[model samples]
Target chain A: MTHTVLVTGVSRHIGARVAGVLAADPDIDRVIGVDTVPPSSLTRGGGGVALGRMEFVRVDLRSPDIAQVIAAADIDTVVHMSLVSAPSKSAGRTYMKEHNVIGTMQLLAACQRSATVRKVVVRSTTAVYGSSSHDPAVFTEDAEPIEVANSGYAKDATEVEAYVRGFARRRPDVSVSALRFANFMGPGVDSPLTRYFAQPVLPTVLGFDPRLQFVHEDDGVEVLRRFAVEDHPGIFNVAGDGVMLLSQCVRRSGRPTVPVPSTAFRVIGDLARGVGRVDFSPEQIALMSYGRAVDSARLVEELDWRPKLTTAAAFDDFLQSRGLFGGMPLTVIDWLATVWGGGMKR
Target chain B: MKHTDTSHDFGEQEPGTAQVIPITAARRRSAGGAGKADVEDRLADLLAFLRRRVAGEYEVDEFGFDPELNDKVLLELIRPLYRHWFRVETLGLENVPDEAGALVVANHSGTVPVDALMLQVALHDDHPAHRPLRLLGADLVYQLPVLGHLSRKSGHTLACPEDADRLMRKGELVGVFPEGFKGVGKPFAERYKLQRFGRGGFVASAIRAQVPIIPCSIVGAEEIYPKIGNLRSIARLFGLPYVPITPLFPWLGPLGLLPLPSKWMIQFGEPVRTDEFDPEEADDPMLVFNLTDQVRELVQQQLNRLRLQRGHAFPPFF
Candidate 1:
């Protein structure tokens, strides 16, 4: 069915790409992109994303006018991707929390009030699972968060998901699909993890090596586009196959790691944040200590789709985009290791 | 032997000795050359392994099981302790399936849970297929700093039904200690006595996955630390199951942390088929409880028989 789609958070790369992709679709009748600012001003990667056949709407989603837009445009699909994962320097934690939680609440409320909205795709995060020692190795959709997110974007995502679930209940006609994405990584995406890797040296929790997964920004946009035009329902985890050890990632990026005690890691993180070098929140700290991985079987089974790039391949792409070089050539390192390890064997 | 004795007794055997010298010398020279060639071949293999690791061309399963790391490094590190320190002897390894998934239910002991490590090494080294055992560790194992990281890298995961079910469904060998901290921290007097299994979660997981339960009994781990006393205050402060006061622990301080060199034996019983029951029976408490009790009894009987055969924890070398 040809339908009108309202895509929020269009200023960012993922949002812009999703909006553009949806607009380019022959099936989608109209794609309305909304954000507080236009796509170019806050866009990171030069030239920004092309809006294509889509129309841009500059307005705060929490404002009552969002409901008016949904009702007036007769939007059939609401794609909510505005939830911020990191606390930006320009915005405080409180603002980010409010923007994520309240903005989601307002958008879902608008969707709930509008009879035209048939499908709601909320871009959720795996952070809702909460990284803790008590967590299962892989979290399925129905798994409870062993460590409840008490603060930061993790908590905000939890509240946002809860609101989306409540909206689904109220508007039984609306098919809600929450895509709990792993850390997004790609050449065009600028996430906290990218910033963390952009640094020359990485400070990590001593004696702890976390396993991390990522979703390429291209995959993120494609997944968003799929949900926007499709009828898949229920929460799904979207991540590339396999996981990379934090140390392995650092090695692959050719960055030196300074292993700090778990307690001192917080101090160093705070110092880095205060210097405006990298954004480090408590949840991110917990993440770096004990990483999170989610099972994307549901997504694959229901949507008949899979990520194009594996975690390692996506990481390599990110490294290349950032111009980071490996420390020693694999051939040389292997030769040295063989000579050394072989000599020891003798 | 007769020639050597005669040569030692008579000085006239010098000429006969001279005739044997060149043959022995030639043999030694060729043996030395072969040793060098063998070393070079091994070095080449090491190079290839290092290359794969450097390029990140290795696979780690969803449960964070680094099979490459476990097979190459972690197991190697534990080998010396298993071969020399514990002198582990394993039996009934043939009972383990060659390829298909099986749940190994073993008794947990050794204040430090060294028994689990020994059991893992036994399965990997002794089993004909050389299957890698994915052990299910308690949350405490994953909560520690170095220990947790190493455990995960070595192919161990948190003791949860989801991980167990996932591992078994993937046709991977999974090991679990139903006793948990209770069996490990019990007093020295209660060493061989089996503790209550936790809620039959492992049984349900095996049933759901349709994997056989391999009852494993480990003897000699009980005497490794000999948990004679517990420092309750210290244990509470550190959030440990127990602060064991072995004879030499607190007295010798850091040196006492070394595990006692006791002979170890691990025996895997015949597979307890879970496929006979319906998968829905996993949710039935009565069936789950009965199966759990039956597995527990099997492990207990094996433990008693093995302990009887072992005679004593530390046997004197003749």
Candidate 2:
């Protein structure tokens, strides 16, 4: 049993949900959520329905002081969820990297030295397998890194996994599980990919319809809970089954798409980023261009865990939550009917 | 591990979560309020399926095989060509395994891959079991935009040892054109001449899966739009494999693009069981080469036999 749980990056939605779920677990004596900054939102009632005995820790993982927090808490299972997918408005690229790379390193170092730490769950992404012309159609868990990752969250996560491996090697007794998730989509997830889709106009590469896979925001938190509680001892790829093409996804969201040239996407993305409209990071652009997908056979066959939603189902759930053609939108349609009839009368 | 109260409480999802009604479902629900003819109803059904597919909700299997789109759009569109123009006839169809998975090693030909498409339609429509042949395609097939999505939705995957092995393991009948671009772009004179077959990769995949290899020989496809020449520079500029300069294509324009009605013959030869050899023997180059040579010779012999039996370059359909 986990006497005390130290969850990193609790400011983020996924981290907060995991912390909330763990705190609610009666078997867990204490749940501490660590974050340098504050959370973005808390109004999510259904999707963010996690509440329990979660304590807060305001410590930066880049600093050496994080070790004191882990050692002091007597944390047995350390769930590191603090890695930022993309930096917020106040922070720059350097801050995001520090929070991801440095935060993960400090947390791992603290875990390595601590005698009480027995379980470690690190949230990673499949972006480490960069998209390219040479990528296999379906990526398995042990798929090699085909292209060199120069910079971005992809590199940060790659470096984070390497350090976690190094730490695991040093302390064989500790159970380290790295979960590499695909793109996240749901009303509550609010990832850059989801944001790109939510835009009124979706820009896609002219001659590419890369396949995309997404995990529901709820499933994302649930998987973290499973890893933290269960003793899964290896790297696993997490994503809902099935894939959707880029063009297909664009149409599904009820958005008109502007087909831009492959090279021009970066310029448009940078412009969008500069104006605070969207964070079209290189990883996300590559994703929108070629798209990425991972096989989760091992997650099911080995870990004995299954997600409730398929990729299509997850996107459907997101669409429903977004209130497209549902809820009050129907009333607006009703108004349109009355106005059109009145105009005809005139 | 200590179990907790969190299991029953949070495990059950909060009620009244929203569900996105597929556009087709939404449209049909509204369309049903107004009555229509049977033909209109069928058209509405097809349109609804296409709309839902475009807006997503088309289900893909474990290997990214989209069956609904395959049946509704892609295969439905190809039915006319398979049945009417370039009508294809299968000989010794029983040589194909009726139930289990088998690797179909067919000769690739014609300026375009109408032969492969015809073979797929033949297997799908005329075969005893009507099994869909999952054709292993090149990287180009998956990289192209609109074509790529259609190909994947129609159950064509990248031709690789990993995929071939996986499909056969799943008992899915897979089709392969081992001759590849060589046979597809070969000149009219080299019509029936087989290519190198790419180092026997498909043979090894069959051996790994311990399935049978069915040697498939196709005739009458080469005569359709016979490639007399190729514009190398122009094709290179467009990033295509090669632009076939057919006798009528560049001169007559789109009219020349239409294939002449040819009586095509698809002959499936007896199966060569890979189970006889050690599954580990897939690594042995000599055995693989000998087996590949044997199959190639068998296909060559069968091709000649079918040609002799047909007795005409453009045999009339019976």
Candidate 3:
């Protein structure tokens, strides 16, 4: 059966890539890419192909116009990828929460009313697990967050996932897939985590080095496209296997780090954000303090697919794109070792 | 007459003894050459290790077990304490499986949980296969900042059933102390008396993973910091189970934190097979209780017998 898919948040990197990939697929007849603003070359980060075949719809999910856009083409699949993690210059926390929470509610409401929509794929976040000391080493999809994210993008994603669950309950016939993606890291992706890593000196929480996982941008888009085109319903964790400690990530990027006490971490984040160095929200700060890793076994078992890169490999790709090496060159280290060894032997 | 007879015997043997000196010198010369090469090889190995650590080029398992770091650094740091300070004597290491996964249920003691570290050192250094013991620590261990990170780097994880089951499924030797803070903080008079085993979570995990349970009894940990009294108010303020009032502690201050030099002995008891029971039986409270009691009893019995054999707290000879 041919699919007429409606993809939200086409203005962003992952959303645009997913729309482009889905539009190129022969199995999908028409891909409707909708966002409040038109997709520009600047936001695409230079690698995505032109999204020529997809139709662009200027519809803010918070408004009632999204329902009309969904109903116009007899769209059978709705892929909601519009959730914003960090506040842009024009938008603040209030608007971001509005776009993420109310926008998702409106989109689901529209999908619920539309008789033709048979599949809904929502791009959620592993932040819903809420990094904390009480968390399991690796979270399965079914594990509830030990400390619920009280604020920020994690809270927004948690609310978005709940709305998706409600939508699934209401529309029993429609297949719903909520992809709880780990932090997206790769070339051509501009995420809060990527911005944090781009800094010259990383300030980390003292005494804490949380385990981190990443899903490469290409894998992220591919997973989104597959879920949009397939019938694998229910929630699934999408992440590259393996985990890297945050300190290890910083060291691998060849950047110096300043250890800040936990109480002072927020102030440091605020100071960094004030200079436009990186977008460090409270949830992101907590994530750096107590890192989160999700088990992607369900993705492999049910979907018969795994990410192409491991967590470390994906981080290395991100580092390569930014022209950062892990540390001092190996040759220099070998030379130093030889000199030191000779001196010690004497 | 006797002196002359002894002189004649020595005189007859002197030339033959002198003939062996050249062969001994040749052997020594080759050994000296190898020793020089060995130093260079060790230096290269140390340099590689430092490079890996600095470049973050090592791998940790899903549960954050860095085998390379654990073997090279963490265990090495504890080896001196295990060998000299505690003078650890390992027994029945043959009871631990050679290859397959096994759960080692040991009694918790030593106010600082140094016993756990010593037990790990013993298994790694003494076992024929030199297996690494993956310890399951309490949440408190992971709640501390530096300690938590180091613990994970050294192949330890939260003392939860999920971690236990996962470690065992991976054919790891998982160590657990079901008594938890109770056994660790008990008074000096109650040293050898086994505290109540926790809600049988370890046994359930062992059954679910179908791994044998090896009862390990570690003596001499209790004497390390003998708790003569408990400062409950101070413990509450610090969020600790107990503020131990040892004879030296709080009286001598920083210097008193040193653990007493007690002779240590770790005895691994017979394996309690869990494969006989179905995995579904893990949910049966009665079976779990019975198995937990059985393991606890085995550990306690061995503790008594080992304590008897250990004799004095600090022995002059083995």
Candidate 4:
């Protein structure tokens, strides 16, 4: 069963990896990767005839012409992964509302127009759950969308989910599945998780322990692939196998972590933003102050998908793959110091 | 505002119209009180009456101490609940008088009004003084059905001058949430920032009644049900006191009302004896207002300190 898959935002990170994976799949006859800019070295192609299966289209998802481009490809399954993950750099709510929300609506409309389209998988964030300590027992497909603080990123993510759900209700034939993913981390990833590692010195809230969950980039691609092939019709918590402390991630990444008092951290985050050295908006800082533990029981049961790597293992793999852990014998020592000193003490 | 001659009523007289004087009805029945009963016997009867009223068909769970044997059931029932959910650490019980009048002013947070209840229970059960702290509840709370009944039973009265005066005259320990709506209603963006308190009603009451004012700082209440956001329309539509989006709300939707288990530290600040100050000083608006602001500011400062001292965001349970 040869299927044509249109994966958006394939110029970087999870999108690029997903495009490569889909192109490799024998089930997928053609993989059309779309991004606003042309593919760079960071993208899927290494410049060879081997890239014949994968086609790169430089079309902004936010643009109205995206529908025409997707239609031209005769896409059977739409894997919508394009989104502004960075709160600081991303366009404001107005842009998100247009690009993420309206773009999604347009993509779904175009997919619906093609009678061959069977499924649509939208990449959502666990940010919809906000910051909760409550063990959601099992974050099933039916779990209600929770509201985050009145920030534009949360609002945009929520709006995107709403559009997908609404479209699914209207077009039942087009099996729509939304993956409420936690933080994504792996080699070649440039998310907040990777950025934290790349920093020379990590700044953490002094009194607060942030319990974070991550989905490895490969695992993220796997989930998307499964969604494309499978006929699932609901939301799922697509996260890593287990959680890790933010402080631990910083220390293990071989970065010096400075424990600034929470008040002082907020002040520093503000000061850093003013000088343009760092990008910690006040909203991001507040969001980072709580535990974002999500249950992925439903994803395992329904999608038959289990996360291959935990955050700790993934972080280690990421560092090792990048050759960043080669000289840093202090990684284990830093982890020990963080754990013993109650730095990661939740 | 024109002051009326009637103690409780403050009505305006219409222009060119005769003033309607309030009629004080004489008691239809009278009882002799010259040497009828001793103070101890009268006190016991009064306590019994209060107990009967409070225990009237309500679901009373005596959390600790035998239901039949315990002298103060309300205190006993609430103590265990507080200890279980909030590991309440109380300090400076000595500041609270064993008997008689004192004004307790504490910072407020957690969209749900648990701090007031916890403090009341703490004073009643854990305090060495074993005094009942009568709280000044907002009018909005008293307007709610079940809440109104429970509040009164739990020794909360309306935050009115007359109510404060009456309670103080009876030698009851009064608690005032001076921050009122502002403190609890402040957005999640400004969690610990103390709101401006109204002119020193609490201070005037303390000075008028010649009582000490104890300022208390309550940590952990702010985090128990952290208001992450507010759905203004929903809150307004439902006529809810406040629409709070805690981690649970965003994580579990409507089920976020359940409080997180946070360790609470209640530090009672040093008492400011109103008796030491001149009675006329209470009327000196600036003096009383400054004193009240100082007390409020002190609690805010302590809360800020505790936020730094006690490490961990979203409570330890998270």
Candidate 5:
């Protein structure tokens, strides 16, 4: 078991939660949360997630200085959670890529030079299995990854996993796990897919109702924490069991679906991207049109881990936590969640 | 200005438009009670289904097999084609065990996969137990977008060893078309000739599952959409195996997609027990090939017998 842990990307919700959880654990002696920018409201040691007994360090993973921080902490466990789910408006394309791919490369290189690091857990997404006409119904762990298109988060993650594999090959003594999580949905973390669903009139491909899968942000953090503490090595898919159709999800979320023809969808996507309203990247469009599924038998059968919420429940959770990050106050959203959820139950 | 009394301009030819209230006891009772119970009952059933769907109560297998949808909705649509249009007569339903894992290896035909759907209907409707058949579909069935989810909801999975072994181990009836596209898309002149079964995969799956291989031979499907010619280039453009040039297709457009109302006969031969050999023998190519040949011969012989029994392509009755 690792005593001191280094968690990268603490500025992100999942990363902060992970660092907080590890710091609160009595067994762990120290928790070092690192990021280029200090999180806005994560008051030094404790806040929403109770960052107990933790220390925040401002270190950019893209620089060679990240190694000095790792060496100073004498960290035995490294949890890399800085991989951005989607490119943000404020963050330019170059900044996002530099933060993800270049940052991951530099961070892995730092870990390689570190003498004490024993276990490394990476936060990867299921998008590595790109959606296409040729995709199997449900991809098992043994299947090869689909060819990702250029300039998408999936492409970056694919390259990230390749680098992780190389790291594992070099350091046979250390254990490395790449957790491929489904779409993240929860109270605080608002992913782009959730934003797309939150639209009043959801757009769908003309004749496609693909099965969509989602994992709660809480479940993602728990899986990451488990890998940080435990010795489960190798790649594993993290997702709930059941899937909901995209139309079904939109309907359940109380939104009407607008069927966009092929050419119209592309045009609308380009327009949306031009003004930075939202991204309808080709990979995301392909996924929305022909939903992808992964067989995570290895998660439970081999690693002995299971997610708490199913896909439908995760969507419900997202709805319940609506308005949390989109300029809506937490107290108001909590009260709304109570009233709305209660009425729906009746 | 020609301003006249607009209300009386028609000279009382038209009756005044007003709301008619049901003031009498009989009228109100008829409006409130008559036929309301029947409508209410149907509404309640629909509401229950919707509630089940919302509450996620319907059971789906690991492979996304929705028994509720398959039994209640999808199979009902196929019943008409099975009963009246095709007038399908099925034999040796007794050979299929009432409850057990069994592999029904059938010949693929009909240019399209109408035969597979009909076979599924036969196993469900004609059998004493009314068991659903878990059809192992080809890549084409799942390669298309909406068709993939529909196929899964209709209780079919991709024809792979993982899914096959899982279904059989769960004691479900599995149906496989070993001839695949080769048997289904062949030219009409070569109709009813059993194509070469691919590499004996079904036999291997059966052997691994330790289930009996029930040879199901389907007749009259070839005549439904007689493939006079094939356009490979056009088919490749649309990502299909081949553009089957049926007599009515391409010339008739969308209206021609429908299959002909040909007479049909389905016969299930005796079970070739995989238990006769060791389960590990699934790994042996020779043993798998022998069983594959045996199943093919069984289905081909039955196909010939059924064709002779009907004596015509479009028999008046089965």
Candidate 6:
């Protein structure tokens, strides 16, 4: 039997990729893509390229009509990824709480109403663990949830997981899985990771060199696809098999990391907020202070899934694809120049 | 045999009918020692005298109250351990009251209860008055066989209010860790952040007994066994206090039992006079909680100052 999957925020980076993957699957008869905005220039379509067996629907997740849309589509599996990832502190507050928290509530309610809906996979984040000092070893699923102080993003993600877990408990037949993702980069990561390379000077919070793990965009989509088809519940840290230092990422990007004290970074973020110079906030500054390295052992052992690319290799591929690096080594002069002088102003 | 004085200088004296032993004479007597066995016996007798001075129930079978046996066993067990693992230093010996009753409250840390034992040894060996301190051990410590036997022999009792009050009333020096398990068992990230202390049990006991409460802070106990993480599931399965992954434990496995040689500085703060307050004051829950918070804040300030002064994670090796 063909499955009708309902995917939210299908116009965004990860959501679009997930929609593409599900549409390509022969067993999936239709994928309903829901987004707040109409297909923008960034949407996944060019010229005559057809979206195989998918349909796009514009529906504000915060609207009362969300349940009606899900029901009309006859969604058998709901992959809820409608969340505001804009680093702009003010922009995400209402959006995240509504779409990520209340929206999931409505989606779960819609799924409950539809007798055919059997599974739900929500894209969660490692931010639930918060930006605190973690054990050098891999943080397993069993590790206690670290307390997040001020970041709205981290707090919202934690609330989302609680809601999903609670929903599963009430509806025993529904298989709900929350994928706590680390930093992911691939073909379309032109989203967040590219900001590091484009900015003149990549600021590094001194005294804290955190281990970062990145999952390829492809792998992220594959994991979601598997979760949609399989019967599994609870939380899992979804990322590539390995981890890297943020310093290495800077080096790989051919950009220099300007070492700044934590206090200075917070000051800069605050000043930016006051002057309306940038979208960064104090909470974003706090998030940047620590790196999260989560364990993906359960995803592999239980779900029988693995990343198709390592972080280093994926990053190199991204750099090559963007034409950022062309057979040249990063030099001491490049480092000193970038460190002393801030990157070209916007 | 000659007597040598190890008593510290307190400066000036109140001339009265109170018998004052001359500092020079005490030193001379302490210096005048005979054979090693005779000196050991004298030390043992001194401990017994101190124990008797402090009024409390003594159970040699259950609590192991033989001073001679304890001194011998402690000397054997701790001396080598300290020599191999710690460069131990004690300060403010003069602050310790030579008179009968006093309460010593110290900030607690280290993976195991090693600092408590070390403090007991410091009081017995180095204090000018040569007081035998009664430490209040956690309930878990008393449940272990070898640990319980050793602790009892060393004059340690369960951390119970009744036990603490009894020991203090008898004019014995009582040591209490207000921070309890939270302070010691804290993970590596939150180290040095003192946990919430229970309402002033030490203060109540001191006030009841008209004793002075001394605030003690120990730096370097945190480094001895740094708790990196904990395996909560395993700890629950085995009914252990905490499944600690210290620098030595999980990394070194069995060999991790040997602690790294960290230099320790244990300082005794000025005593708080609880005698002025009425014993009825202990009954006021708000007063007791406020007093405990005051003591905790004072200790925290001292710890912050010490951290600034030291500046290094590990002590400098000479």
Cα displacement (Å) at residue A302, model 6:
1.6
lDDT of 6 at B213: 80
Q: Interface RMSD value for candidate 5, one decimal?
A: 7.8
Q: How do the residues A1-346 of candidate 5 rate in per-residue lDDT, one tens digit apiece?
A: 5799999988878888899889888889899999988764465634456666778899888898889988888989999999986777787667888889999999899889999999999989888888765555677777775555565888888889999999999999999999899888887776778778777678898877677788888888888888899988999988887777775666456555698975688899888777775678888788877787777889887657678898777778887777322222333444554564454334
Per-candidate count of clashing residue pairs (backbone under 3 Å): 0, 1, 0, 1, 0, 15
Which is the winner by DockQ between candidate 1 and candidate 5?
A: 1
Off by over 4 Å in 2: A40-51, A325-346, B1-44, B47-51, B62-64, B315-318
Where in model 6 is the C-alpha error above 4 Å?
Answer: A41-50, A87-92, A134-137, A190-193, A271-279, A325-346, B1-318
- Tens digit of per-residue lDDT, candidate 4, span A7-66: 887766677777777888887888988887655643434641233467888887766777
Clashes of 1: 0
User: Which numbered prediction scores highest in TM-score against the true structure?
Assistant: 3
**lDDT score for residue B69 of model 1:** 87
Docking class of 4: incorrect
Task: Please give the TM-score that candidate 4 achieves against the real structure.
Answer: 0.49
Backbone-clash count (model 2):
1
True contacts kept of each: 0.59, 0.34, 0.49, 0.00, 0.12, 0.00
In candidate 1, stretches whose alpha carbon ends up further than 4 angstroms from where it belongs are A41-46, A328-346, B1-33
Worst 10 residues of 6 chain A by lDDT: A337-346
- Restricting to chain A, the TM-score for each candidate equals 0.94, 0.90, 0.94, 0.83, 0.89, 0.86
State the lDDT of candidate 1 residue by residue for A1-346, as single tens digits.
9489999999888898998899899888999989888898335435777778888888797687799889889999989999888887777788888889889888887888887889999999999999999988999999999778899888999999888888888888889999999999999888888989998889898888899999888888888888888899899999999898887788677777889888887887789788875876788889999998889989888879889998888888999998986667675876687666656445
Q: What does the interface RMSD come to for each candidate?
A: 3.6, 5.8, 2.7, 23.3, 7.8, 27.4
Candidate 6: how many backbone clashes?
A: 15
Q: Report DockQ per prediction, comma-separated.
A: 0.31, 0.25, 0.31, 0.01, 0.10, 0.01
Q: Write the per-residue lDDT of candidate 6 for residues A140-161, one digit (tens) a residue.
A: 6766654543556677777777
Indicate the worst ten consecutive residues by lDDT in candidate 6 chain B. Answer: B53-62
* Ranking 3 against 6 by lDDT, winner: 3
